[model samples]
Target: MNQKQLVSSALASVMALGLVSGAAAADDNKGKEKCYGIAKAGQNDCANLAGTHSCAGQSKADMDAGEWKYVAKGTCKQMGGLSLAEAKDKTAMMKK
Candidate 1:
């Protein structure tokens, strides 16, 4: 194949790999709530990010301190929240 063709193939392969890996990671992270958060006023819940599992408080604070959009209402669900593996197991059981 020509250089351009070769480069195109390589890029496509890398992108596909990235997508697959990302999906896998997300699957692995299922159910684990992000640890960090400032919590919303009187809500008793914090927005936990899906990816890093980090609480939304820090992210929200970085995005905008006063904006109400930063806060998503709801508790982490579990008592203190489950780890990724635990969450996945719980999810699997629920599916059954």
Candidate 2:
């Protein structure tokens, strides 16, 4: 192949590898659940329902009712994890 064609082919291969790895990583979380009110500030796994931030590790407060961390599915409650409704209730109580 020509020089430009060789470079393009290499880039395409790298991108495909990245996509495969990303899919595998996503599969790793298949049994995870979003456990709210358990993550420390700046340590959440993803965005919250309240849109406080759009990415992980961006929370501004500890135990944010809206923020969540990934936990083993069906173990959220056992781990003192608050559901969205429970979190809201706790927040309201704290405010009162």
Question: What's each prediction's TM-score?
Answer: 0.40, 0.65
Residue-wise C-alpha lDDT for candidate 2, range 1-96, written one tens digit per residue: 899999999999999999999999799899997899888989999887667579999998887788899999999999788987887787778778
Error of 2 at 91 (Å): 8.9
- Which one is best on lDDT? 2
Per-model C-alpha lDDT, please?
0.44, 0.87
User: Which regions in candidate 2 have their CA more than 4 angstroms from the true location?
Assistant: 2-7, 84-96
In terms of TM-score, which candidate is strongest? 2
**Could you give me the TM-score of model 1 versus the true structure?**
0.40
The residue-by-residue lDDT of candidate 1 on 1-96, one tens digit each, is: 899999999999999999999899767656544422223433223333333333323333332112122222244332244443554555456558
The total number of steric clashes, by the backbone 3 Å criterion, in model 2 comes to 0
Report residue 89 deviation for candidate 1 (angstroms).
Answer: 33
